[model samples]
Target: MAKVRALDPSKTASSLDTPTDLKPDGVAAVSKALNALLADTFALYLKTKNFHWHVSGPHFRDYHLLLDEQADQIFSTTDDIAERVRKIGGTTLRSIGQIASLQRVVDNNAEFVPPVEMLRELMNDNKAFTANLRKAHELCDKHDDVATASLIENWIDATERRTWFLFEASRAGDNSGH
Candidate 1:
């Protein structure tokens, strides 16, 4: 057998080398916030899709289509969030357990939820998600990670749009107060 060689600690796969000038703490800060946001995004995606699959009543087709569209949008965001972490030399979430641990959004496991209730819950979750995204953007700003911040700006706008659509969908005839 060949002689065993000692591994060099500095060049381990767990520690990635970043091309950017961001310090270690900055990377940690940004990565932590982004991962948390990523977890929440995943949670939101699943919940929206759940509502899409289970939605019923007079507006079934409309709500189903809306939730499907929102789910796709939420799912698309996860990749960007994960890639941003890797771009900054930070490892991202690896498993469902990790996502569950990091996610701030609560799961809805009820056997049945009314279509309007589903829309309202999802709208509230999207609103909270917007706030969380804002917080993450603030952290990115603090770390001067402009790339991440710009991505977050787009996400915030998308989330707000989702919230607006859900809110409008969940209300009665005069929901718009027009």
Candidate 2:
């Protein structure tokens, strides 16, 4: 029940930017794909931020720092993705309204969650994002956009690995107790 500060977007980037090589039609597809990515990334950003703000339990200190790092990384990447959208001749979605309306990632209320529950929820969200990234990369590849595909693929892999690590941490020691 404390005040939470939102990240200032201007400090993150000066303007939207897209790849210069994309053709018009391909740029259109990339634009739409980036829009989808922007939404997903924003949702994940908020989720991580919420976790950072509200997480508590035995793992409070560790999870607190972890969630903060996750939120920072997601915020940076989301800005990059949105800028890429603009570089490809499209505009990045700017409001929570656009993100909430377009994002596929599920948002959870993090007003009061135990640390374990927060980790579980974030693990699930990361898995969902990994899947979404793969699907978007496939579409990018279809448009012969190997650059975008590579970029998304790398992120998907990282997210999947991070989810696995979080999942394992959440499940650790529980078996010994029960």
Candidate 3:
């Protein structure tokens, strides 16, 4: 097998942007949309993990495992989203502050959110994510970027599935110390 080389430092400069056929404006629009999506994904992942760690009550094990699984799924998309930006000759987010600025998902800082409430909130977040994914897919279509649209389609389905699970989990089973 041939040895692979890392990114050439000089060639990775901003002036030497990755080549793409998409219009410059299209790249900018899609990159901006994708970065926002990425930021929301990160926020959702962290909130899922937070709920996973803090969840209490009788059904702790099931809720914890579900959240862990969902968090993993949410995190798996970040690299793809960010790399798609670079592939389109655009930059991706570089800092937590940037993520916070772009993220639309609301943060949860409550000292104690009831377990059932947590499920409801996560479900809503997933629903919002699905909506955002649809919007991104539409933007990608406008830009004639089928590759990113395909990825967004998959993410939309996954997010809807997560929302469904959360809905079921929180539907009626838990008491939340009532």
Candidate 4:
């Protein structure tokens, strides 16, 4: 068996090293864009989870399950976003306050809201997120960060699909048949 080495307790946070071929300015720009995306993702995840827990009406089960699944997908992106920041030699969000400060998504703490309204709000938020992702993807492209741009492309497609589903689900009737 190989011997295990102990971690050096003397190492400080600033001592962490991130080596990359990308310039410092490019890294900073990409990291800033990714941080904004991360913040929005976290905010959206919380809002979706809140809706999941509070949702009610004739479609309670369907809405609750949809929100839960959507929340999980949003949460899944946070780690990747943060990791991308670090990979590019920059830091990421550190606290709830930091995330709240950076986030653009609006919070809903109302005691009650109509289920249709909730669905509409989330659909709009997802659309906004996709817009933000597109902006970030452009930044990545500007910086020539192919990896991050590719990831954002996938995210954009996924968000568009979410928006489509929500729009369809919120429709009042089978208008497509007309």
lDDT of 4 at 167: 79
RMSD to native for every prediction? 6.4, 10.9, 5.9, 6.0
Clashes of each: 0, 4, 0, 0
- The C-alpha lDDT values of all candidates are 0.88, 0.77, 0.91, 0.85
Candidate with top lDDT is 3
In candidate 2, residue 30 scores what lDDT?
Answer: 81
lDDT by residue (tens digit), candidate 3, 34-87: 999999999999999999999998889999999999999999999999999999
Taking all chains together, the TM-score of candidate 1 against the true structure is 0.89
Across residues 117-176, which tens digit of lDDT does each residue of candidate 2 receive? Answer: 778888998988888888888888877778778788778877887798678767753566
Residue-level lDDT for 62 in candidate 4: 84
Model 4 regions more than 4 Å off? 1-14, 172-178
Which residue pairs clash within candidate 1? none
Clashing pairs in 2: 17-83, 17-87, 18-87, 18-88
Worst 10 residues of 2 by lDDT: 1-10
Candidate 3: minimum summed lDDT over ten consecutive residues — where? 1-10
Candidate 4 structure, TM-score to reference:
0.88
lDDT of 4 by residue, 1-178 (tens): 2222233459753554576666678888999989988999999999989988998988888888888888888899889889989987889999999999989999999999877788889999999999999999888888788989999999999899888877776773334642
